[model samples]
Target: MKTNILSLTAIMVVSLQGFSSALETDAPETITSMGQIAEIAHATQEFFWQLVPPMDDPLYIHPDGIVRAVDWKKFKNKDFTSQMTAEMKTVSSSMYPVYRLTVIETRTGELLWHNSLDQLVWQTPAPLDYNPYFFAFEHWNVDSTEALDTQNLLWGRSSNVGAEILLLPEAFMESYEEDVALEAEAAALAAPMAMMLLSPPTVTNLMLAIGVESNEVEVGVYFPSGYTNPVDVFVCSSLMDWDWSLFTNVSSVGISEFTWIDETATNSSSHFWVAA
Candidate 1:
């Protein structure tokens, strides 16, 4: 039939070239490691450590009670995201650490001191409610010496960027029975809070200013969610302006500074802090 109509038109041109190569496709996209999920992004809730201090290994205290001692070592987060494999801490932390002590009177709500297990280890993950004019007193003419020089303008802006603290450093009263590095920094502030947050505040714990000097900051409150209302937590380190009360409002606001991550190699890997 003319060679069977050219073999039935070569089998209908190889079945329409296998149906137009199966409707033209590339077929790529199968990579996945969707291991961790439950993402609601923007984190950093619960963490209120009153008058926060202890960047690490400190139990030191001595407005004069005496107990000079020392020996310890060191330590991120934000409206925090944590894509940690199958692990995390976007905020809901506890690697384990608790041990507290308070010596109030930063300007009333006065407890003025504690010890003998500080009324059972101070315990205040919540419930403080402060406000003795909640810092920097936002005008009634902001007294308390401009509300402690506006909370010593946070270590004079910690490297500086001011509105007024004018070079923070003037209250290191040495005679706490003759200082031994302030009795090894008040026996390193009673140690806990995960080992005083790995120690790193030394502009000199000055305060009670006579020359506008103050340092010994460690404030926290960051809530960002959970039906909102905490207010960027910081009263005596200036921030929460505008006359709202209840101890410097407090919720959160971060990004202090300092970043290295980790290090080791020095075969031109290099490190020198400043060694003459």
Candidate 2:
């Protein structure tokens, strides 16, 4: 009887090992919903890295040839607030079953903000622009014509590491023409400048990288800095549609006579003034 019991115990151990192996091998090939969102965000970040200058490269030079770049690492390791998380959660709540999103910082990999595509509050009630949804905090100077034009600076790191310069000259022109036409039609009405620099379609690339069918059909610019305070915003979609000539003209002419235009429309339906 004792011998039989020993044999039974050995068989049980082997059976458990086999079960564990099976579980490991069959571990669902499907990506989790959260994983998909994270993957897209990661892809966007990588794209930003490719567009900007190398960390050691100089972004600008003075008459004496001084160089600079934005160092984004400075904003690392910060904690997320409950309110920010709630805002992101609201966005996620809207897009049930289909997709969910989470917001996190690039520096320390901390989830500072997040929301689902469904929870986003669309004031205009049009199809959602993915760029603004992902990067809600980004902002930039509307009247910094020189920065927008000659500087070719798009998103900058706090430490001066420059990335994603706007090179599309045509997009700038189209934006300028549109703004000018709108102003003319309005007859002294103020309108915010439509021109914005953005990163390429990294989100799509990211979806491809992860080997999943990305539901994220469209992309847009994400300004981490809100309209009130200007910071470098990321460009992902509508980049090809922008008019680059607007920047060129501004860079050539300077902002001495520049006047304040209308404020930019916020994701929350607020407005921030812009100068030209």
Candidate 3:
């Protein structure tokens, strides 16, 4: 009887151990892939673009047929003309693309003067005085006094012609460093998420965490289950800013998990996690 009792006790312990091991083996957590992180990054960018405003501004035109305002005094002086000529030469040497400046007499619709499309320099028939207003269009350097003179001629002449000035718009202007810096903040946030999509299939789960305080920023990922080995993570950030548009600072986190299981057990509870 004693022997039978001891045997039954040993059998019960063995059965309990087997049951516990079976329960552990029955449920396995799944690993996440890098592709999922990329999808999230793309979606976030699309959302940001849609939320931003258009970058272009309205054209500046005078009541008369001039595209810009002109200052006659600067054009009339010999010293001013010489300085402007030298500046124009420097601008030409820069190999910048030429823009046409068209001066038209609105009353007769006749072209009065045209400058080289390759060179913005203009030899005015005479130093401009307040009279005989004219309208003009040209690609003028934003930094050049000569360009300012051209713009002034257009504006001053338009005032005389009593015609409205019209200007063609450009798609993009100059980039601002400050704007780029701000945009970089957002890009840095999104890049990690994008990097996740570059991983292989061994990953089954991933998690991302981002935090920022004052000037300090932190990013982390958690891999609680599925992956048997440590995975690599990459992060990147770039700054870009343009004169016409605004960008929001964005931050993102990405994670990837990996696992190994038999093909036949793929659909079984052993291959995935279950929440209570």
Model 1 residue 180 distance off true place after TM-score fit, in angstroms: 5.7
For candidate 3, write residues 90-165 as lDDT tens digits: 1112322212232323222332322323232332233244222222222222433444553344332321221122
TM-score of each model, in listed order? 0.17, 0.20, 0.16
- lDDT tens digits, residue span 1-276, model 2: 011111101000111011111101111123323333334444445333222332332322001111111122232323311111111111112211111223333222232223232232111122233331122123343433343433333333321211111111122334433443554546424433322222222312211101001221121222222222222222121222222122111221222222222222212221111111
Candidates' C-alpha lDDT: 0.21, 0.23, 0.26
State the lDDT of candidate 1 residue by residue for 158-184, as single tens digits. Answer: 111100000000121122213334444
Q: What would you estimate as the lDDT of candidate 3? A: 0.26
> Which stretches in model 1 have alpha-carbon errors above 4 Å?
1-101, 105-108, 120-131, 138-276
Q: How many collisions per candidate? A: 29, 47, 26
Roughly what TM-score does model 1 have, to 2 decimal places? Answer: 0.17
Best lDDT goes to which candidate?
A: 3
lDDT value for candidate 1?
Answer: 0.21
> Which one wins on TM-score?
2
